[model samples]
Target: MAKPVADTFSPSENAAGYVSDDNPVLGFSHMHDSGTGGLPSLGNFPLFVHPGCPGDDFTRCAYSLTFRTTSRVPGSVTAAPGYFAVNLTNSVRAEMTATQHAVLYRFGFSGDEHVDVLRDLKRPDEVEKGVPYSPLVLVDLVDLMNSRSLGGILVSPETGRVMGEGRYLPSFGSGKYDAFFCADFKGAAIRKTGTFVGNDAAENPKILDGVGSGFHIPGGSAGAWLQFERPTNNSLLARVGVSFISIEQACENAEKEIADWHFERVESDARKQWREKLGVIEVDPTGVSEELQTTFWSGLYRTLLSPQNYTGENPLWNSTEPYFDSFYCIWDSFRAQHPLLTIIDPIAQTDMVRALLDIYRHEGKLPDCRMAFCKGFTQGGSNADVVIVDTFVKKLTAGIDWDTAYEAVVSDAEVEPPNWGLEGRGNLVSWHSLGYIPWDDTDLNGTGPMSRTISRGVEYAYEDFCIATLAEALGHAEDAAKYRRRGGNWRNYWNSDQRDVFQDPNDVTVQTDYTGFMQPRLVNGTFRYHNTRACSPVQEMHRCYYDTHLDTYEGSPWLYSFYVPQDMATLIQLMGGPAAFVDRLRFFHTSGIAYMGNEQGFLPVFQFHYAGRPGLSAYFVREYIPALFNASVNGIPGNDDCAMGAFSAFAMMGFFPVAGQDVYLLSTPFFPEVRIRARTEGKWSVIKVWGFDPEGKKKYIQRAKLNGRMYTKNWITHDFFLKGGTLELWVGEEEGTWGTKEADLPPSWPVEWADGGGVGLDDKF
Candidate 1:
């Protein structure tokens, strides 16, 4: 059985590094997911050192015994930005730090005897008793994360360089791909080296290739080993670089990034890079606990994990355009993650937009949830369109080919790929024909696999709005009118007859009513009942219903009921005006239906401002920071999903971006002062925020001032942010009616779609 380890709160297998406060020391594995849940990929190689080996040479070394120590090590593992260290139970101290594409590791041994280095490419679950750890270095080419190996090779052992390449499939709808690696042994010389096929050393084999055959178990485990000479300091440092292209490229990456491995220089440079990335927004950490400050930085750190930079790593074709993969999924990111990037790093955002466009040109569609060079199951809609539009609309589309980019968006909106659900808009035909997606197939016994038709209907509506905005920007008025009209199709799912009635438990006299909830309906207009707390007459409607119980994606119908961001005015009116909407918001919060952990309810926190209750928005957002989040390993409630990290970053900075729009909702910041370095006129400009009484109980914003004048509303425009200015907010102990007036509320665009040159298309573009 596999050894017991502490729960590291990591759900994805491709996690970069894994740790738990009290867990036993599992050998540090390379390549890990930040925060995800699925059959993970990329725990590709784990390195460990074993003492008291049976053989002195690689050929006679035992290959098949477990290397993990039986007992757990206490208080051993420590992790920081670009660094991780652990002292194993076996008295081997290992420390690791990373660069952009490579990692440098140092292993220190306590015993004076010669030791063996073990490289296990086996899946975590596949580790078995009596499995050989022989051979200096083993390369298992067959077993990968939900992948079958096509081919692999380990070159003849050289003094300081060890190189290998394997072609295998990645996880979850990903295509087959190649992984090439090159490692540099800094202080060790190769004394022995050998290759193995299915657990036995290959006899007189100069080159090992082809599918596994003639082994005890065909295509079982194949690898190469290199035993190194003992070092003077009882330590060994290795630098490894990996690429999907070629071994030469891997070596180049290491040479360019890590160069000569002065472990401290690489480690310091890695930490410095992280500091520079997080340094975009400077915060005065005074008054907040160190833990809270760490939480903010860690959240920012998690945001950069995926949509990995694959610039020169695209295996299919060579292109100068920036290429990125491991989108993991864009639906989880387009909301806050990409928007946050627009504010902090416009250059990175522009490159990301270009990368998405490049993918469209090469693969014939924008990547939805891409991994391993292939499109996987799409979560909701073509959210990459939303991401591109969000950046494009913010005027961040400079230097990008706008015409070609717009064509890609139109292709996704209009064309249907063969596997519509995974890559392109399969349901667009139904959506275009019917105002909303009419449930023509589902609604039987709820066994429709991959069915989230109602959820998709709402997502499609928002996506249409995104396209409409792009259309308006590009002077395509007719296209804008058509898509803008379709954007409001979210109303079709709003069943006015369905009411969320709240009554006083002790006294039946007091009660409240909230109407116009999202209901599942069929093509024939028959309402489908969900087995939920709210829908079940026998069950007390206290806890929120899971999304799966209703015909929604990742959130319940009640949560989906508030999913309308493009037309919040209509949503407010649909919920029975501002007072009624605020009351319903309170009900959702008090009834445990408001899941603050996910993207579904992310925007609702800002909707309070739309209700002319900016102080309440500030209050709730402020309290939520320290309450729902922390600085520990389990700080995030669920999958970072990139969205949560972005949200947390925004929350710390005292503002939230209205996705796809230039507007930002205001809130009281956790810090006393914040500054953002804005890029303007080919230089960095300063955007400063000063809050009076930031650390005290007087945490409510009484009023805000822009420049030297009093700002009426509770928000700022992206143009103002880019131009740079001073924003000052006065705080007090009690809530003040600063942004409570209806006229002071943020602008809510009308849902009506006006055709025939309403936006002056002839003059704009």
Candidate 2:
């Protein structure tokens, strides 16, 4: 659900605390991605909740959930996803719940009097533009983005009137706001009305409407809230909040997308759906804390939430009605999200891959930014190469012949060239082919394109490493050796004097006096050159690349530094010592310069645990857990692109494949107690904990056991969490004497990484 806690419209929705007289309570809506930079949101409600008092302050209300929601439910109770309900002064213990697609709401009113379960009768329809840009740009933009327009086919099969008001609120960014189709729609009487919130807005109880009944949904973007009235007995009041980008599609949902009925039926269905997806990982966590539970589960929520049903399988995919899905920064996520897909949920990942691959087959390549059925024409690189290779290396795509994946990956890399998504990318084929992409590789006047080639040269090297490692594991020695040489492409870019990673020419010695056009010095700084003390700009552009677009890029530089995980050892040596790496990571965390409040520098913050600084990772988990779990009121700080944001939280809880490889790494705990309801395939197993006292401090896991058996490694394999498992981490406030070294972080050989053994294949030639 895309509900925003900040704008819960209830008392304590976020900072404003309680509801003000100016804005009375309406039924809480669910699901929404914050509309920023003139972009739009997608989500809708499933019910209409009308409290008798139209304009009463929240303080006067009977039931208030306050601010007691955790990461799993970070929003206020009223802000919770699916079914969100609360008590009111009007004699109703209102509650709501959502089943993957449909919602169930039950309201317990003061009297046995028939309450409203009406369909389309509460709020009537109209046709015309809700508002326009320019003068009302800020307000109307939200209206436009959240799919709110005043014009639509309001055909009445039977004559009747509905009541409701509309409004727009400030968007999170500079000039934006969220639009809504909100209204009480309740004049007074209940039971007599049959109001069913569906895609086809029906006015008469028996008659149905279709496409002609749909509206403009200003800005050509979408997101809406439907209030579904759930009838109840005695005092159990329930109403489901359904949020969606297309009210038309939302109406089509229950009948098609997410259907069926029943209370536990929906909840059980959701659980079953989640299990099918989560069961891909067989994680057996030991000594988990309660905070981790919320953080991890919530994190899981983030990953599974995105890249909704977007395009279709035909040529008409882009123009279809349900064409838009998956919004976020692909530049950052493509590095890990796509790779992580292979390890956690191969089935869903398969479908996702097929979707992107289809895009490739049709458009000659995949798009980095596809928003609302349109090409955003955003940043690019030969990411499709990286994605496909990582999948083939991990052997994740089932059903698709491995040869198909291999051919897709290899052929694309050969033809697309480095920085494929960037303009004039084909020019660097030779340089990338030879390993390092030099500054003067091809087109000198093509500053942006050449720079990207080099950057992608570095990224491609990463994929090569994955491929090499995987090949070696599969006994393809010749292939492994060939790719290993290719993986060393980063070496060609290394500058000894600069002690920096630069873009190199096909020949290792060829270099050029390059201009950092992408991140023109804040004043007079160099690109990846200065080692002593960098001007703020270097750090700012690490995660994000500032350019012709605007000022700030997606992520900060602090977070970007540590992403070269393959060279952690070399980076350590270059930085002077492991102690230096520790110091830098600590700086990132303590200074707030790294900003864990967002997702950019996410991986760097936890580098401590990987570097034998268990105490450090532990301290971080404890220190920053609160902010991480509650980073969103909308859909995460920036773009979730689905559950990638959630998985970041999941990884934060001590388990996740590092950089999307099948390597699991564990960290210290932020909370004293954590619990995950374990279900293997379909059978549920009671997961319990004891070492996490809920009173421990900066607890570093001293020991771990899987199924009560002690294990050597701190991380789980990709094969684990997916097949149903449990992890019981022990809690302590200090580092263990058995901390592993950074070099030993990810197994250097596939044989040694097969879950229960080690092989002497370090640096095999």
Best by TM-score: 1
lDDT of 1 by residue, 462-486 (tens): 8888899999988999999888888
lDDT of 2 by residue, 558-640 (tens): 33345455555554544445776687678656644555434445556556655567556656655655544443443243334
Error of 2 at 662 (Å): 2.4
Work out the TM-score per prediction. 0.86, 0.61
Give lDDT per model, in order.
Answer: 0.65, 0.41
C-alpha displacement of 64 in model 2, angstroms? 30
The parts of candidate 1 lying over 4 Å away from their true place are 1-30, 52-72, 114-148, 158-160, 197-207, 211-221, 441-450, 501-512, 531-550, 681-696, 753-765
- Candidate 1's clash total is 16
| Candidate with the greatest lDDT versus the true structure | 1
